[model samples]
Target: MKMRKARTPIIGKLPLRKGTIGFRLFLYTEASKRSAEVKKYAKASRIIIYFIDRSPHLVTGNNIELISLQFLHRQSFTEKIEQLSEEYDILAIVGTVQFEYNDIPYFSLIDIFNDDHLKKLNSIICKDEPYSEMIQTLENHLTMVPSVSRLVQRLRKVIVNLELQLNVNLKEDIVIGMILHMAFLVENMKLQQPGRIFPNMEEYYNSHKEEIAKVKEVLKDIEIEYDIKLTDGEIAYICQMCLENQQL
Candidate 1:
């Protein structure tokens, strides 16, 4: 008798290409004197802040580099855009109203500036809900910078405590929580210095073995219930792989 061959499962390709959403932000001020004034204050304070949540991918690369040159000596916005367009594949440009500068609030920049221009910028940069939410969240949170760090620390502690109380394994919930925590921290760090190193999963796990073991045990129970044959590490790795693929 002839044996039947098992059919291979076909994987569907994702529609979005990797790195296609890449963008560069150009902050175009009106004049040289104004640009110099802004730069001087920014340097002295060592804090360049915006309410908009600019993507780290764009801010760290050639996008910022080209814009910085134009802003350094007060070149025209047109010149800055020209230079940036030449260097990178600019997906969009956004114009943000400086509602606050160095903690001094300015409420009328949006009204004073060209609303149509701002709208055009918004149309280009605004892609997904997450992107819009991130920007709005950043803007709201910027006003509370005095409590931001402490608030984040407290939230992380609360999440960790909840994980313990729920008897949720550190390898799964705790590790995932820490990953999110680190991502936030990295994003904060990048606001100051672009392209800073972020925390690694292996390093985080190695430092918290006891917690990881607890997570592993809980995951084991879950695996048994689901009839999944994967080890804890394998499960985590698969999750990460799936997330990475989805982002592309």
Candidate 2:
């Protein structure tokens, strides 16, 4: 996240520790004046992206702290990346910014690496170019908040569908929470078997019958689309979310 004055690499990779959920941005440029001499220096670095979930860390660490520690020890950061590639899932490769290769998906530096917004890290080094925001957006995608994660890509459909079905224009956090809740429902609906009673649903149904009805309609549509039936209790649970999202 810290900027180096020397024009080394214009694109910045994600600043992440071991066991974190994100990726490293590797830059590739068609050999220009600065990089023409370096061996294996294509225009851009082929990035093998990965994401892993772990127990949350304290939100107090800075990206530079890790880099400074690595500098002090004179450790090879590339070696660490190799180790991690073996340890975790390699999600995908980031193809060129403009071209859509047959195998690799393209990513843009302006969205993922910029400093103006979505600051998972406190800083971004656009000394010439930046890549952190790009990786953070990818992280959001892997985390199921695809609206922020992919930056106006396929998740826009998910947003539009949810809004249309549920009849609410959700704020970002609510959208995230709703998707996560849906994920949980999908995972556990079979085990939980959905007949267990929660009194909150009854209160919600009594007070907000209209939203409760909307939840049933939406859930029916979801069942038809996804080919999975949600129990009445599940419908009620999401109906409660509808009420909450409306308040937000």
Q: List the lowest-lDDT window of 10 residues for candidate 1.
A: 99-108
Global Cα lDDT for candidate 1? 0.35
Tens digits of lDDT, candidate 1, 15-121: 23333333333333322357666665454222222423343322332222223232333235446554544444333222233321111111222421344333323
Angstrom error of the Cα, residue 45, model 1: value is: 11
Candidate 1 Cα misplacement greater than 4 A, ranges = 1-20, 29-48, 54-80, 90-120, 128-248
lDDT of 2 at 198: 57
How many pairs of residues collide in model 1?
2
Candidate 2 stretches with Cα past 4 Å from truth are: 1-159, 165-167, 190-192
Q: Between which residue pairs do clashes occur in model 1?
A: 169-215, 170-215
- List model 2 lDDT by residue over 114-230, tens digit each: 332212211121111122344354454343222232222222233333354454555556655665556445435434445446577666668877766655654553344334577
Provide the TM-score for each candidate, comma-separated.
Answer: 0.23, 0.34
Clashes of each: 2, 14
